[model samples]
Target: MMTAVAQDRLGGPDVLYLTRRERPAPGFGEVLVRVRAASVNPIDAKTRESGAFLGDPPFVLGWDVSGVVEATGPGVRLFRPGDEVYGMPLFPDEAGAYAEYVVAPARHLAPKPAGLTHVEAAALPLAALTARQALVDAARVRPGDRVLVHGAAGGVGHLAVQLAKALGAHVIGTARSAQHPALRDLGADELLDFTEVDVHGAVRDADVVLDTLGGPDAFRALDTLKDGGTLVSLPSPEDDGVIPTAAARGIRAGFMLVQPDPVGLHHLTELVDAGEVRPVVAAGFRLEEVALAHRFAEAGGVLGKTVLTVD
Candidate 1:
């Protein structure tokens, strides 16, 4: 048996509770991970409340995991039984990472950076991969390009700032004045206080804009980009009315859903090892305190990621 946080029905954070379940085993090309830590993302909260992408309850809510490989199934070669690894496995599908053990496709994970602890490693996968995919793969950000990140002090936003900088772009970020120094330290070249100033007017001619905050905020970001620039909206869907407006304005706009990418995870590992990128964990709760953790994550105003210690 393995310990896990599960919900029998869809509702608030109160719906979450601890339970015991059969320990999962790896399948073909898969690995069984002894989860040491897992990070809570906004998707987890949304799924918990409304079944977002999950569709129902009686489900485990976590993707980000940092752990030791316990066993390998057929055709696995990337890791051994004792290797330490971290990843956001199965993503929109459930990998059941909020447990003592999880079975994941071997290709969905990468070696945990040696410089980081399990908690820090757990914090990186989903949020960091979102930033990397948006900036590098989707936006195609280039050296000296102007890259603007909305919600720059939040989970995905903070990592986006550092990644844009690492890609050699001049990174601008939107956050409260209180977070300016921290964003600057993370390599953001310009910091805009969204509460104090209008972001559309404050930043202009950005080569790429990562819209971490969806809705009207994504629409507002259109004016901040130069013609032919790319605007990648992370939280919003494609049909949110931003795409047509972007086309009319000679800009490219679309939404991106993060997926499990071992290659991207390796690149992130390189960045972390080289000191170019680091995940900021706002808080951590034990496996039993998942409900409290969910409440904290849903309450917003978090500096970075929230995590759960499975041990």
Candidate 2:
């Protein structure tokens, strides 16, 4: 048996409780991971509230994991029993990473970056993959392009800033004044104080706009883009008019969902090893304190990711 954090019903963080369950064994092409750490994300809280992705109770919630492989199932040739690995497995599905053990497909994970500890590596998968996919794959951000990232100090935004910089794009970030110094150090060329400035007016003619804020901000971001620029919305736009609005402006706009990709994870690993990127772990809680971790993440203003360290 292993300790797992699960919710009996969909509601507030209080619904989360620890329970003992039979250890899950890896299936074909999968490996059993002894989780060392996992990160909490807004999706975990949202799903806990509405059961959006999960249909019923007694389901584990978490996608980010960094750990060592304990065992492997048939046809799993990528990793051995002691390999240190990390990934966001079965995302938008039940990954059950917030537990002492999880079964993941071998290809969905990559080697843990040598520069990062388990806690720090736990912070990378979902957020880093989201940022990398949005900027590199979807938007095709290129060198010398003027790229603007909304909500720049938050989870995905901070990584986007560094990635845009690493890809040679000129990156601008929008965040509260309090987060300016960190964003600057992350290589954001300009920092816009969204709380104090007219964000749309402060910037214009960006080659690409990465909208992590969503809703009205996603629509307004179109004004900051050039005629042929692209706007990638990481969050689902609250309004349905985003597409039509972008079409009218001769700009391309779309939403993105991060997926598990070995290629992308390998790229991130390379960047981490090269010192161009790093994970930011703002806080960590024990496996039993998952409810507190969710509540803390929901309270907002956390500079990086909140993680649950499994003992």
lDDT for 222 in candidate 1 is 89
Give per-model CA RMSD.
Answer: 1.0, 1.1
Supply the TM-score for candidate 2: 0.98
Query: Model 1's lDDT to the true fold?
Result: 0.92
Give the RMSD in angstroms, all C-alphas superposed, for model 2: 1.1
Per-candidate local distance difference test: 0.92, 0.91
**How many clashes show up per model?**
0, 0
- Candidate 2 has which clashing residue pairs, if any? none
Tens-place lDDT digits, model 1, residues 107-198? 99999999999999999999999999999999999999999999998889999999999999999999999899888999999999989998
Q: How far out, in Å, is residue 3 in model 1?
A: 0.3
Q: After superposition, how far is residue 177 of candidate 1 from its true place, in Å?
A: 1.3
List candidate 1 segments past 4 Å from native. Answer: none
Give a tens-digit lDDT track for model 2, residues 1-311: 99999788899989988889999999999999999999998888888998867878779999999999999999999999999999999988999998999999999999999889999999999999999999999999989999999888888888899999999999999888888998889899999988899999889999999988788888888889998899999777446898888888788898898999999999999999999998778899999988889878888775788999999
For candidate 2, what is the lDDT? 0.91
